[model samples]
Target: MKLIIGGAFQGKKEYAKQQFSLQEDQMRDGKEADFEELFRVPCLYHFHEWIQKGLKLGWDFDGITERLLQENPELILISNELGYGVVPMEAFDRTYRETTGRICTKIAAESQMVIRVVCGMGMVIKNA
Candidate 1:
């Protein structure tokens, strides 16, 4: 599995496409995809949003991780870095940020490669 992360609109998706030679159909937009679709797609964008949805639906992180690992062990995940900005004023936003960070940490630990993309450039943070 490969994990790609950066700020919003930071070219994470483009970097994944170029690096992986992925076709348009191989990548799923998390904002629009259902959980089932997310599992089926090789690459998933907006991964943080999917986490938020899972939280809203009362799905625990362990369940989400287990399902994802079972379905797509070779997945490429793209998520924005949500913890760097000013702390959110709303409780939900704060929770979302924290949850995303924690989940990303777990994913990174398990991933074969982790890349941080900024301004269209990708820096490999981990390789296993």
Candidate 2:
């Protein structure tokens, strides 16, 4: 799996497409995709939003990383970098940010490549 992260609207999806030669239709939007879709899609964008939705729905995500790596080793995930700015006052927002961060960290550690996009440029931070 590959992980692409950046600030909002930083072109992470586009970079993923160009880098991997992926078609736009092949990528799923996490906002609308069901949980099962994550294991089937070739690429997923807005991953943090999906986590937020799951949290709102009180969905259990235990062992998600293991499942993804096992079920979809070729998946590419694009998430906006969270927990970088001021902490949110809302309890849910804070939890969402922290959850996304922890999940992303776990994924990145196991990913074949981890890239950070800024101003439409991708910088590889990890290759394993």
Candidate 3:
């Protein structure tokens, strides 16, 4: 599976479509959650931790890995790259950035393709 990754607000999806037809496989951002409201953010950071929690509840991070063998997915994944910025002050802010960083790293490593979009340009970060 190809994992296209990039920084915040960069059009990662616009690039992911250059090679493969795009499909949204996101298990996130479809609904508003409580934890997100508590943090006053329904942002990537909150979703990062929330997703891991859901994964334990039977969501398939690994199943996507296995599905690659049976299906060729033009999976267009949009990830907010949070590692390249300044440190946050609030406790929640720090936690969110850290969690997102870890999640992105893990997924990027396993992807067949990786790309970094900067200034509306897409640069390939990985390939199978």
Model 2 agreement with the true structure over 1-128: per-residue lDDT tens digits = 99999999999988888889999899999999888899999999999999999999988888999999999999999999997879999999999999999999999989999999999999999998
Q: With candidate 3 superimposed using the best TM-score fit, by how many Å does residue 28's alpha carbon deviate from the native? A: 7.4
Q: What are the lDDT figures for the candidates, one per model? A: 0.89, 0.94, 0.51
lDDT of 2 at 98: 94
Candidate 1, residue 87: lDDT:
98
Report the C-alpha displacement of residue 65, candidate 3, in angstroms.
Answer: 7.5
Task: Identify the leading candidate in terms of TM-score.
Answer: 2
Each model's TM-score? 0.93, 0.98, 0.58
Model 1: per-residue Cα lDDT at residue 49: 95
Query: Mind giving the per-residue lDDT tens digits that candidate 1 earns over 96-128?
Result: 999999989988988899999999999999999
Residues 68-123, candidate 3: write the lDDT tens digits. Answer: 32443443345666666688887766765776576556657666667777766878
Question: Cα RMSD to native, each candidate?
Answer: 1.3, 0.6, 7.7
Candidate with better lDDT, 1 vs 3: 1
Best by lDDT: 2
> Which candidate model has the greater TM-score, 2 or 3?
2
Weakest ten-residue segment in model 3 by summed lDDT: 36-45
Clashing pairs in 1: none
